[model samples]
Target: MVVKRLSALKRFLIGRPLKSNELGEQKLNKTKALAILSSDALSSVAYGPEQILIVLVTLSAAAFWYSIPIAVGVLVLLSALILSYRQIIFAYPHGGGAYVVSKENLGMNYGLVAGGSLLVDYILTVAVSVSAGTDAITSAFPSLHPYTVVIAIVFVLLITTLNLRGVTESASILAYPVYLFVLALFILIGVGIYNILTGHVSPELHTPVGTPVAGISLFLLLKAFASGSSALTGVEAISNAIPNFKDPAPNNASKTLMAMGTLLALLFTGIVFMAYYYGVAPQAKVTVVSQIAEQTFGRNFMYYFIQGTTALILILAANTGYSAFPLLAVNLAKDKFIPRMFTVRGDRLGYSNGIIILGVCSILLILVFKGQTEHLIPLYAVGVFIPFTLSQTGMIFKWVREKPSGWMPKLIINSIGALISLIVTIMFFLTKFAQVWPVLIFLPIIIYIFYRIKKHYLAVGDQLRLTTCEPAMPIEGNVIIVPVAGITHVVENSLNYAKSLNPHQVIAVYVPFERQEENDFEAKWMKWQPDVRLVTLYSPYRSIIQPLLKFVDTVQRKASESNYQVTVVIPQFIPKKGWHNILHNQSGLVIRTKLLYRRKVIVTTVPYHLTK
Candidate 1:
């Protein structure tokens, strides 16, 4: 009854499903269903061009102007890729993305590579898009400067929670706002361009933004392309979530891809044309959409509305990541590359663990960068293109192996995508070395480590399989050993905590770092009454682990004399903030590890919460 009431309350809070039966088949036609996926793809319009313009500012205005060609190239490539993915949906309707396609057609290693790249790309998409949105907000209101990343992170956490609740809930909540933003954007761009073309427009924020460089050099053009390519980041989300659509996955996917392409082209072209016509140099310091709006709308109500709408769009942009990332995690989990928690869905049928993980990671990124989108912009594209290049190549391989009846079209289209993505990736790499290279190396190393973990899990599972039900090991006494460093709350808590467990015997063992520390422990020992007796172990070398190990070993040896158990209670200070964690408790970790490996000992961690 409580569950049903909660479900009803949730439904009331979010909305009723698009279909009558909540768990039944979706009744949304291909067009309607396509809108949800397309929204994720199309929402890139909000910050995609902004990313390009921001990057081009590194060069002169003339070079920044060349962002036009880069935008056009990206749009063209986007169309080609959409067409290619259409073939992918048709070929693998069961929903095999880059990894599945690569593994089935190419090899296992290629598949793992694709999965790793995709996972990194998914994480980057969240960071970049949210950071970009935060930038737009900061641009409008300078007071929001330091808080942009904080706000963006809050939004990430909120969106992740919403997604964990369910996609249908999130879609219903976000769909209208996203569509409204797009509509508002299209109207603004369409009318603004028309006004500029008819010579009825005034100058923009960076009016007549001076060009430092003369002609667009090859390097300049490549940089522009790399920046503009950020617009194409979320295109694969539709393919990733193809299974979530209504009936006819292929048809829905194709229609969604087409809508996304059309919207993307219009958005990129419209924004570029507006900025170009008004001489809004791509490499200017006019940070916010408000500045851009003031240039056009001239500090009117429309300006405020535009700023508000941009914020709305940017916040929802994280929603794209929230929805898509969980699916990627689920895919990786299925392949046993990620932990199985990602595969478990909530009562609402959403990947809850995956959502929380993405939220926390994105929040950390936003906090670390202090919500400054400009600084993070450089690192963004690196993670995006890494997977894009690998995925496109994987598709080509998939096309080759499963040479379907009409494989020619897919072959040619995916071939173009692969070639373009490869070139763009190279361009981005060359353009973004100082800022982005570290991320490129770091993400892959982390991914490879996860792969190793997967391998180890599988190997260990097989090795540790219990062949037969052996007799239960006899209790070796409940002798509790209290690991003490000094007489802090951590130590007292450990003493009280071990006593609370009601063990057979509790002995407080202290590693004397200095005479003062030993003296302090003795002074504080009588302040509280614990059932355990205290013992001081001297360390001549000021070593923590060795002394703790020797004490635990002595207890273990004594335990054999009388079938008693030994439980080592290590007192640890848990800091409220991460910075505090770095400073405190270096000795506790070492002691805990040493005590854990003893033959017949149980390790208990008694953590006392401490303020920074």
Candidate 2:
């Protein structure tokens, strides 16, 4: 049992022993997991419209107030989009995220592009959401502002460690927080709504800032759309996380999407309505939600409670990213579009390597934007929309390729869905290009590099293809070549061992350098093994690799001609300290690689463990 636990730990570090089943052992019914997924996306209500207001504030006074209508429009559009994805869930719910949809329909290349884009978006979701959450917390306690980035980072690290321990462990840990966030939103929004409906609604607006933006233009509307789309960011998380659901995965996934969609719409509507009721417009100077809280309860306990919840939810937002990115990485690896290491699971049976890489990237983003959601908002929407565009386009292709005659309902709905998503994607890119174009430019270069890597792996596989086996040949003679730098105990022990192998003959090959005062080693070898052969090759430029390689070739040619079995024993010293690895010794790999090409020759490393 102890050994099994130790082995499990080793595997966790390397990414094995998946914990999905462990989560199941707790028997979280489908409704529970669905609630977690729904709660994750639903929490965006705290900041989604605030993102829009940040951008629109750059325009006119009227544009500032336009956030209300825009938020309503976005909520409706997002609900429709969520409904569309329900079809996708039922159709391909074996964890076929956008990447799989795009790959199955469009092609592997596009799938990879979509996967990379979604990955970046999800990472941003975590960073931006958590940072925003931290902001909300700091608003409650102004003292924490200076350390907000540190707090955000700590949040990311905790989530990453939990995830690395296993998916089930992570889900179990996050379930209550997600539930608390949901319960908090319902209570707050519920009471806030009742207050609005009743004549008891009190007048509350922030201590007015400068005159708000007025007369918003088409471009301004587009920018608002881009920002508002952030609310829809984690909808795809459901697709990525479908695999984690209990059996009847598709039904569970569809129900989860529907539940999420309903809850998100209600939560966002409540928040938006309450913001308007309190006359809080989201501008760069005054984010709307903060104003609503200050108006509702002043700078007192209730205000602080909402602020604390915001911080908690934001920190938890990264949980959505943490869960999704690994699944996407798995999809990319399965397609042979990324490094094979991503395909492997770690000791906790989660993709720890991928998780860490994503966490680091997210932390960098949080720092770059100073944990400000407003600043990162522009870069945020482009990544999410890029994948949205590709996935919808792929679905169009999927519909076209299938050419289902009697399935006109499916065709018509998918076509409409595809057209709308594609147009939204393009609009977001056009509006957000200046703000986010650098990320767009950078991601493809990375995706292309991954493409090249896959190509190289395939090329090597093609080369190694075996056609026929060589007929067996009897060994006529045996030759041993012990590569020597200096006759240390390691070299002496290796030489002695090689001699004992009782080959047809033994020879010691040494590289002579001009600066070396190692004359004693050759003399010692000669004195000790007078009957053994010793060959020394001179390297004039002190270049060791070429001369040693040439001598080995010459010896191999002679051995092959005589049908000799040559065994080369290279003495290697394993350092006790890691830092000494480079300084103390080199050339172990170089020598081994060169000898690998020769046939009928066996190369062994007699490793000496260096003791402190």
RMSD (Cα, Å) of model 1:
8.0
What residue runs in model 1 are displaced by over 4 Å at the alpha carbon?
Answer: 1-40, 51-65, 94-96, 202-215, 283-292, 464-612
lDDT of each: 0.69, 0.72
Which stretch of 10 consecutive residues in model 2 shows the poorest summed lDDT?
203-212
* Model 1 steric clash pairs: 57-283, 139-288, 149-371, 476-564, 476-565, 477-564, 477-565
lDDT of 1 at 122: 65
Q: lDDT tens string, model 1, 37-100?
A: 5654565666567666666666654444556667778887888778877766777775646666
TM per prediction: 0.73, 0.86
